[model samples]
Target: MWSEETPSLNNQQYQLLQELGRGRFGTVFRCLHRASNRLHAAKLIHKRHLTDSTDRRCLQVEPKAMTFLSPHPNILQIIDTFEDADTTTLVLELCQRRTLFDRLSDDGALPEPHAASLAKQLLEALAHCHALGLAHRDIKPDNLLFDDANNLKLSDFGSAEWFGEGVTMSGVVGTPYYVAPEVIMGREYDEKVDVWSSGVIVYTMLSGIPPFYGESVSEIFEAVLRANLRFPTTIFRTVSAPAKDLLRKMICRDPSRRISAQQALSKFIFY
Candidate 1:
């Protein structure tokens, strides 16, 4: 059971405002703190939906994980957590500018410089998480939020894993297009999986399309497993050589050869 220390306020302490968005696990709403009148996003997850042990465990892990990365600027901050008999509510810092996915959808592919700037911030955040023995298995643009200042923040930890030395995770989890080949092959993998997803995100940011795509989920997975990564001349013609080099290192088929977050930050010339 979660303790009272996790949540400083209950339902009565805040007024729920407009709906922010919805995901497989829950719905997020823009909220107002009654006393302070400050804005926050509240994620309401139904307890009944988490009937399986794995699903329930993720619910428990999310708050703790958020607590672990709270001080990092590029990771979303959890303000508080609350629960009723029916649902669990998490109070979070609201990113009013929406997600990176929204930006891509509305503005098309980003210019290489802008993409590089966002990618650098993302790698910094991932580096912080990996240093602490955490792997954010999901790293799609949809999970990346932007604050009013347009600074990117990594959000959602439902698929995240915490490991110790020599420990590797084995599971087929994460979005299909972003999942690494090692994960699809059912091999034990570590934090490097995030690097692959980040690579896919960078590819999409520059090309307005994912490196692997298909008409169905199975086809997409097949493409991810066997497809060769290509930088179409139309898109790559204007992109920098250093940027392409970084992308190749990130999306390597062999996880062992995939660039670590720290390496990506130190070796690449994003500008």
Candidate 2:
């Protein structure tokens, strides 16, 4: 729930268990709400990180987006929020399992069925975001977390932005491998950027590697700008033709030609 008044966040309300992970601005901890005795993930973003207007805008947008777009099974839900002079804490649903990135690191690639299942969930979540005028600028394996049931949940709205119909967003956002070509060219873009990133996720799931790569970040950007979508015969020999077709429609370099999240979700590849 959202409120104009900042509620005092104190140790009396929640018992911080342990650190789950760290991000650019905050440390996530496993916490228990004393009143309910229920477990939740608490991300305490320090005020010190609010060094610029951009940082502050992101801080404001993250919680607002989570609160407005959540209660979604495939999108991480925020239980509550708190504020103090030093920190802003977001109490979120606990997804006590590895991220999709961790699974990929350990298991290489997933079978088509498993990949399609997760991809569909991600797309559905994106569809929900786009419908609400929010663009998840950063969509990658690291942001895809799993719950106890291994359900895919899209998380981390630190880079999310709100856009209007027919309007475009500008910025060099998103992770290296999953960033869209339009973003790399410093062109104005829309929600389709997330679709491009999701396509990269699907490609990685099926082939065990990103379609574009480089020895350095610059090289990776160059490869992404080229936007050469390819499937190695040896690696993709077992992948079905429909899956490849779906990837082409999604990962296309041109945002105008790229399929929307809803369109990708309806593709036969998932069914």
Candidate 3:
């Protein structure tokens, strides 16, 4: 529940608009600067959630990674950072094209060409992040955004981490449906996790459904561990065999055997 009254850095003025979204820690609202009429999304993080050391640490990491990612076409542009009371608001580019999830809901599975285009943009973003030693632990469809060009913009850095010197953690975090097997098993993972999730998203985009779903969380975990992915060929029969082979590599049960994001980008039939 974000409001216009939320404070800003150096006492900057803001005119609040509609709430953009709400999450476990805070709500994000669309806001505008009074002086410039610059549109932005203000993310309000409650003080309580920041009390935890992990949360605080992750909060600190956002600015660093985002600043490093500045000016990327497919990355969400963080414009300003400010604080009001106990809340920390990040002024970000206001995107209105809705999420990939919204698009999928409205259009069901996308055709192969569209999916491939989106995947190329996403891979470019991920490769950029990897170059910065950053890993976006969460890469599900819901986090994908669209800018003015209706192009893909991967947002949300709350779970992102750097695998840099003396900083990598073995902890696991991500949506079950899109997570990689290594991440679910609590093993050391790096950029590969994102590649696997992208694979799931690609599959979903083509088939309009997740490859593995189950009755409970436990079952889903098992399915992920075994990489129990099955796609009815009839629907994708027109899709190339090379594309299917790439999917097989992306969803491999073992992370070591899974396709690398760089290779996945060019290996698909469309590429």
Name the top lDDT candidate.
2
lDDT of each: 0.88, 0.90, 0.81
Residue 137 Cα positional deviation in candidate 3, in Å, after optimal superposition: 0.7
What lDDT tens digits, residue by residue, belong to model 1 across residues 100-218? Answer: 98888988898888889899999999999999999999899999998888888999998899987999998989999999999999999999999999999999999899999999999
Give RMSD (Å) of candidate 3 vs. truth.
2.5
lDDT of 2 by residue, 11-64 (tens): 578888877877788778888899999999989888897789888988898899
lDDT (0-100) at residue 18 of candidate 2?
72
- State the lDDT at 175 in candidate 3: 92
The better candidate by TM-score, 1 or 2, is: 2
180-252 in candidate 3: lDDT tens per residue?
A: 8887777787677888898889888888888877888888888888776776877787666766787888888
